[model samples]
Target: MKNHNVFIALLHYPAMAKDGKIIITSFTTMDLHDIARPARAYEINTFYIVQPVDAQRYIIQKQIDYWLSEEGRKTNPTRHEVVSMVKLLYTYDEVIEDIQKNRGTKPVVVGTDARPYPKTVSYQFLREEIEKRERDFLIVFGTGYGIPPDLMATFDYILEPIYGAGDWNHLSVRNAAAIILDRLLSRNRC
Candidate 1:
């Protein structure tokens, strides 16, 4: 999805920003409920990179329930918006192919903000450069357990890790995307 449209969706909530680029943000496992709305808003254009599991049906059902609940309704007009926003579900090979397709042509920024590791530095640098140039960006998230090492290696940058204030173990993937989107939007003046 285009970054600007994602930014506008996020702005629907008073807490999120109203302008600029949008990147992915993570939510702690426990706070998935809190982050669901912002995540749905950003998911309009953001790619959700999840692990391949046998329980895909169950997980998708749970996600549907989460999106249709009161919290999701408060943030989005209807569940279909969230359902339609999900664009791709890929294995590692597909992700590699997707990256290859965009390399050296359009600016593609990948955000991996969930984990903090030096390995993510290179991608992070590349992402920063893409943003500095005001180009198109793409973000990837990993689910199931965590992002595979190989996929993580493909990110343009790992977000600067932040410690959550609450009891949550870590930010949920949804909230993490919101944070990334928030930062991206903060960068644009238009």
Candidate 2:
């Protein structure tokens, strides 16, 4: 299994549209729930939902609070265990800072895309690197159209796109993030 120091971020702000503008997308409650459960199940350290909008962030937090409440916990005990791992942060800087403080050093920022990118690395190599435990990693996933080009440049390495059987190459950010993490972390399954 990959080290638990690795984190995942679901980016909502500083993302892109089809046009050349940076936009803040709204949160999908289901995606937040779906992603977080799998993350905790897969033993990921933390799941950060990076949103700049206060209203959107409030809604997300409320949902999290519900899951953490006594009634919600009684309803689904395992889910409560996982949703507890979700952290709502406003900026990339907060994620970076938190990782640095927790890991006691800077992390290797990795970005994911639906298309090929420069400095793309293979999953096997990334998995191997994770086993070395030399550094922590934060893998960022974009929701809307995709991650912005400038944002892509910030990453130390971009993971190659997740390919399907055909040329069609779109997936819910939740599914993509879960699949990517599973591939990188699953030991016996692989």
For candidate 1, the lDDT comes to 0.44
Against the reference, the lDDT scores of all candidates come to: 0.44, 0.88
| Model 1: per-residue Cα lDDT over 1-190, one tens digit each | 3343221111111111123222222322333333444545444343333334435435554665666677877776555455444333324444445444644343343545445766454434543554464554555544334444454565555655545676444655556666665555444434
Over the stretch 68-88, how does candidate 2's per-residue lDDT look in tens digits?
999889999988888999999
Q: What is the lDDT of residue 169 in candidate 2?
A: 85
The C-alpha RMSD in Å for every predicted model, in order, reads: 10.6, 1.4
TM-score per prediction, in order, is 0.50, 0.96
